[model samples]
Target chain A: MKFIHTGDWHLGKLVHGIYMTEDQRYLLNQFIEVVAEEQPDAVVIAGDLYDRSVPPTDAVELLDEILFKINVELNIPVVAIAGNHDSAERLSFGSSWYRHNHFYLTGKLIYDFRPVQIKGVNFHLVPYAEPGHVRHLLDDSSVHSHQDAMKAVIGKMEQNLNPNEPNILVGHAFVLGGETCESERTLSVGGSGCVSSDLFAPFSYTALGHLHSPDAIRHDKIKYSGSLMKYSFSEAKQRKTISIIEMNENGSFEIRERTLTPRQDMRELEGHLEELLDPKFYEKQKTDDYLKVTLLDDGSLIDPIGKLRKIYPHVLHLERKIESVDQKQLRNFSSIKEEKKSELDLFEQFYREMTTAEFTDEKRELMAGIVNKVLKEEAQK
Target chain B: MKFIHTGDWHLGKLVHGIYMTEDQRYLLNQFIEVVAEEQPDAVVIAGDLYDRSVPPTDAVELLDEILFKINVELNIPVVAIAGNHDSAERLSFGSSWYRHNHFYLTGKLIYDFRPVQIKGVNFHLVPYAEPGHVRHLLDDSSVHSHQDAMKAVIGKMEQNLNPNEPNILVGHAFVLGGETCESERTLSVGGSGCVSSDLFAPFSYTALGHLHSPDAIRHDKIKYSGSLMKYSFSEAKQRKTISIIEMNENGSFEIRERTLTPRQDMRELEGHLEELLDPKFYEKQKTDDYLKVTLLDDGSLIDPIGKLRKIYPHVLHLERKIESVDQKQLRNFSSIKEEKKSELDLFEQFYREMTTAEFTDEKRELMAGIVNKVLKEEAQK
Candidate 1:
């Protein structure tokens, strides 16, 4: 049995205040061509079909059109699941009837885990869920983290599995020890998001999402097809690809990589403004690609972005070379369990972000009173 | 072909700042029983399955459950369409596959309107669409108002119809001369939202929604199944019922109404606070029903709402008898093309509503600047 494994399309993504709909459309159009050429028995989109619960209208239309092309036009079966980014209830609409056409889309969790069997292969779809929600659903108090949640869910699923036949687990979670990029870097802010890969030992393979890098995890049996495109500059060097997996009756599989290039590649260019703008240098580069230009000059030039945009039409970002280190430091500070800051501390930070007004004792005291009242209500709840 | 024709469920409705999910659930549970006992050949939900686009999760679950019961469990064909309140794209998810089970859900309007043929009946499902959307779709510039849109849609549909066969047009629109309650009265505030009943003259029956009263139109062949419940205080005198239509092969039909009493009826009580609170007055009334008390006393009373709530746990509204005329005046004034007020006038009214501060000349000048800028943008668009 053979299938294409892909996920984390994030169809309605917006990066650095730029709508990525056109970028996503460019890549997915090519993806459909690949699917048509390969003509796999089935297509497995692990999770994260959308970037957010309430996607834009165009994103909804794009998803509908692409799914119709795959499942109806090409007559290939598609199995999709809702990731944490999706509204499970919205995705599961018309699901009861969808199975008749070999279009399996699972969103919400069910206690009785059943594999969608196609051609003797069992595909267990465990969509991304909060650990607390999973614990309540399963009536298990011991589930405290992503690892514990996945363990309990797979444990019950194991009872209904046939070890003799090949089984695949389609999931969306940060696996332990996986590499991360700046965009998805926030998922493991406190490093509690990842689940251990060892839990899927019973399955022939585990196809996953949420991690933007394809090589986030290195095990041959566990794969991250990676996001459809480079979501951030940190992923500029990463190769975006979908995986084509071939599994035999013996439960052994071989994997091949299929790379899809973005129409406008994301790149970072650092140089002195004068040298960077030289006709010789400008003529040699792919100026149309989305670029982040870093000026090496210590003194700021007038309208650097304006000047850069003339040469590189898609210059999306501009910065002094020295400020790059400050950004990195801020990023590190943000990920240092800083979201768990005290209420007053968080409020002070928010106040600074929202206004140029100074934080005085009078305002601080007023905020403190409100914060205490909220805490009181929280305690009562 | 006998079918249950019902619509305007408004499943996730909230009235008077009170959640109506429980009330809708109570009525719908009985609705399923009616379906089971009657065992209609088909179920045609005209439109408005939900109160609004982006309904709450519970509404989604309830609609899913009810549809599952009818289409999958009871094995009856269910045909539905999107109303004005629905997001067409969201409702049409997995629609291609839903057709295999005879669950026809039409959301978005298309150029070619095809009728779903079931048991010799050709059911034309014309979902509610904006006038501009229909004009753009049909490439006919004449489609301007709700009446024109419906006329153009039905005119195109008429070309594809076989007059000898029983044809039912399932639609969601305010037909001309349809009676409406306070909840849906806003739709025709200026009386432009309604279409003429003559548009459905070609069809054997036109099952409609939007109007909350079943007898909204007097035509024998054109009838409104009405909303699922009394969504407004103005509907207190109206009996809520679901229409079951028994259509024969010869295009003749018999209609029967199945009334479902609300668990807690909505009622209005008028009297002096003291008289209303007396044991004699309280004992005769259904204290548990949702109540709106009108205090007829000339002087104000202390804690009248608190006192009334002791006997009537569900006092949703309280008003002084003298102020009732003011409310009616406001309602009348609002429906008299008030929404088309000048930008500055509308802003002044909004400002008055939001703040106790008076609208001074200085603030008026500041607002005029912003309103003019917005009007400029609107003109450009």
Candidate 2:
């Protein structure tokens, strides 16, 4: 049996406060094109299908179209689980009915060890779980951390496993040696979230998520397919890939890595404004790539995005740097500064530093009065 | 052909600021019981299955359970449509695959009016459409009102109608004489939103939504099933009912209204608190009823909800009335009447009215400064 293993689409991701929905669609379309060409027996999406729990309508519609194409049009079984970023209840809305059509989607942790059997192969889907939920489900007080909870979950899986039959484990968690990107949220504190790969050795092949790099973690049978796209600038150098696993009659598995081609590469450029505009500096640059351009101009550059996108049409982000002016001139009036200034003065300084605007004495006096009133009320309390 | 015609379940409605999910469940269960007992040839839910476009998770789960039971377990067909309140794309998510088992859910406004032929009955489903969408779909700029739009929709329906076959039209809209509760949003101004029943004269019967009263609108072939439960306090007197229709070979339909047995009755009690407490006042009250009690207690009653629920058990809303206070009288204040007061006086009055505690002199001075500063800035703007 041969099938494709992919996960962590993170459909509505925003990088550095910039909306990445358009980029996400471009990359997801590439995945679809690959699937159409490969035509694998089945598709297993491990977890983190969405970046946020409440995805926008457009992202939901895009995912809906892909899922419809895969399961309905292609007639291939697709199994998916919810990760830490998803609201399980929302994702699992019609899962019970969806399973009738060989579309296995599990968001609730109660069915952690219930393997979905299709054509004699058993697929055990384990969604991400909290330690508290694990402890409550296991009815054991000893499981206070994720590691302990995972051990209990593995023990439960052992009961359901049929050693003679082929079995595959799909999960979302941090395993040892897993190279996590900046976008992957911390599951727990103090490194307790990471679990050992040996715990999942029982399965023929374990597909995992929670790490963006496909080669982040390595074991004999465990692997991370990585995220669908480069989510952060840190992952720009990473070669994202999906794993295609083929299981023989003897229940042994052979895994092959297939490189993913993003629609447009993600690139960062930093230099002085004049050199960036010289055109000679960008002879080797991929102009169509999504760009993060930072200008080192001493003063703010006019229409930075317009200027950068002239050479690179997909300039997704732009920032201007203005050198700080010397403040030694203020040292001459330091005598009065020793006195306790009103809170309004502090507000004015903060306003000036954060926003490009002018402040007046009347506004300062008003802000100070409001702050003083609140403080006075707090004192009475 | 025998069928159940129900609409506007509105599963997650809030009545008078009190959540009525439990009451909603109660009536919905009664609806299910009716379906089981009647054992109709099919179930047709017109539209507005959810109260809000973004329903709560529990409401989604409840609807999922009912649909599974009726369509899968009982092996019955269900034809539904999207109401004005629904997000069409979300409702149409799994509709493509669900059509195999005869669950025809039409969220998009199809222009051709292709009827779903099931068991020799031709069911034409026209989901609620905005005037703008109708005009765009029909490619007629003159269709600027709902009446004109709906007329065009029915014209499309007439083109596809088989007069010899049993035909039924299911829609979500306000017809003439349809009494609407506060929960139902008005589609357009005046009578423009309401389409006359004569539009469906060619069909055997019509099932309608967008009204909470079963008896609000009536015709020989057109009927509203009404909401499953009283969605608001204003609908306290509504007798929630579903229309059970039986079609004959000659394309004629006989309709009957079946009252729903709710798990707990919803009622409103209006009287003086002292009188309400008297056993003679509420001799007919269902003790376990979900209630909204309006007390004419002259603002003398303390802990009204705490006091009323002791007897009413489920006092969902408790509003106190001390005769009808005029808005002018309510806004009349001693501070406003004072002469030549500064911004400090305004701040002090505002603080005093909103808080349980008083403001100090320092705080008052600070507030005055802030208000003055804000006013000065506004003047410049």
Candidate 3:
């Protein structure tokens, strides 16, 4: 059984206040082109089909269009699940009826543990669910974190596993040791969110989402297909690709990666403003690419962003690196200072700083009177 | 061939700032019961499934649950269309794949005019479309109004009609002579929106939505199922029902109405506040029903709405009849008085009313100076 594995489309993503729907649409069209050429037996989308719970109408339309092309037009079975960003109820709409057309879309987690069988492979789909939901569903009070929730759900699937058949697990989780990017939402506050790679030991291959890097984890069986594009500047260096897996009768598989060229590549540049914008240096580059230009100039520059934007029309971020460092230090010092002062003391410090004068006894008495009135009002409330 | 006809669910409607989702859900559940008991060959939802173009998530869920029960679980076919309030693109999502399961959902108008044939009956679906869309689709510049748009669409469907077979036309439009209520949105300005009933003369039966009354149009073959519940105070006395049609072999049909009991019926009451709330008058009424109380007492009443709400918990509107009548007349007189005056003249009249003083020439000069300055600023813009 051969299949194309992809996830984290994140349709309707807004980066730096610009809607990325057009860019996503262009790349998704290319993905359909790849599917046409490869003609895989099935397409497995791990999770995170949408960037938000209630996505804009266009996002919903785009997903609908692409899914229709693949499953209805191309006549290939599609197995998909809902991720943390998706509203399970919304995504689940029309899912039961969609199954008749070889489209398997799971939103909420179920204890039935039934796999969607396609071309002899048992594809176990585990949609993302909150710990509370998993706890109630499994009747287990110990499910307190994402890891616990995934373990409990997977444990139920394991009970009905067919050891002889080629088994594949598709999930959205923060696996232990997987590198994350700025655009990926944190599943939990601490390490408790990370699930061990060993949990997939029984499967032939475990396709994952959440971490936005193709090489997020090191395990041979556990792999991340990564996001469809560079959602953030932190992911500028990550090579985005779709994984194509070929499984043998014995449950062994060979995974191959196919790279997709984005309409506009996300990139970061560091240099003096003048040198970075010089035609001789930028003439050969992809000028229309989304850029984050960091200026290293020590002195003040007049309308730096305005000047940079003239050449790089898609410049998303512009900053003076030296000034940002100074501002960071200043922010840290002020926060520490603020932590040690009471409301009245902070007010007094602000007043003295503004006037550049010593605190007089009369001014202190007036400030005390104002503070007493505020305290009285608060107590009454 | 027999089918249950219903429309204008208006799910997620907000009447007087309260969401009517619960009441709509209760009534729709009863509608499902009727479909189950009748065992219709198919279920035809004319249009306006949602109250807004973008329905809330709960509304989407309810529509999904009910459709699933009718189509997948009950093994009945569902034919539906997009109404004026629904975004055609949003409702068209998953429609292509849904066809495999005998769920035909049409949104945007298509020129192909392909009829969905089920149980020897040909159902031609014409979803609501703007004049511009019909003009472009049919390549006819003459389509300039709702009437013209419907004429062009139905004209195309008529060409493909099989006269030997039972033909049913499902639509969402304002028929020329339909009695409309305040809750139904006007499709267009003036009389241009009214599509003549002659447009449906070719079909065996015309199932329509948009108007909120069951007996909106005086046509034997063309009928409305009415809204699921009373959506406005003007519709308080309207009887809401589901139309069940039983068609014979030669396309002749018998239409039956099934009235659904809502969780709380909407009603209007008029009397003195004291008399209306007295146990003698209220004991025999459905006190929990949604009420619009009009007070008749000619004296001052303290906290009337609050007091009425104590007895009629679902009181949605409260007004004093005499004061309202007086206010209406005053409003008309004031509007007519204000319409014939310039900005300065209106301002001077307002000043006199507030201060009970004459409009002095000095005050007029000052007001003219401000008005001129505002006009000058507007001219510059």
Judging by lDDT against the true structure, name the best candidate: 3
Better of 1 and 2 by lDDT: 1
DockQ for model 2 equals: 0.32
The regions of model 3 sitting more than 4 angstroms off are A298-307, A322-381, B323-381
Give the C-alpha lDDT of model 2.
0.79
Ranking by TM-score: 1, 3, 2
Q: Number of clashes in every candidate structure? A: 0, 2, 0
How well is each residue in A241-351 modelled by candidate 1, as lDDT tens digits? Answer: 999998888789998989997899999999988988899999999989989888887443688888888899888888775433356545644674745778897777556
lDDT of 1 by residue, B38-113 (tens): 9998889888888888888888888888898889998999999999887787787767777889999898888768
The estimated TM-scores of all candidates read 0.84, 0.82, 0.84
- For candidate 1, give the DockQ: 0.46
Candidate 3 lDDT tens digits, A125-171? 98888889999999999999887888888888889899899999999
**Between candidates 1 and 3, the DockQ winner:** 3
Q: Note the Cα lDDT for every prediction shown.
A: 0.85, 0.79, 0.88
Q: Highest DockQ, which number? A: 3
Q: Cα lDDT for residue A68, model 1?
A: 85
For candidate 2, give the docking quality class from DockQ: acceptable
Cα shift from native, residue A337, model 3 (Å)? 6.8
Ranked by TM-score, the better of candidates 1 and 3 is: 1
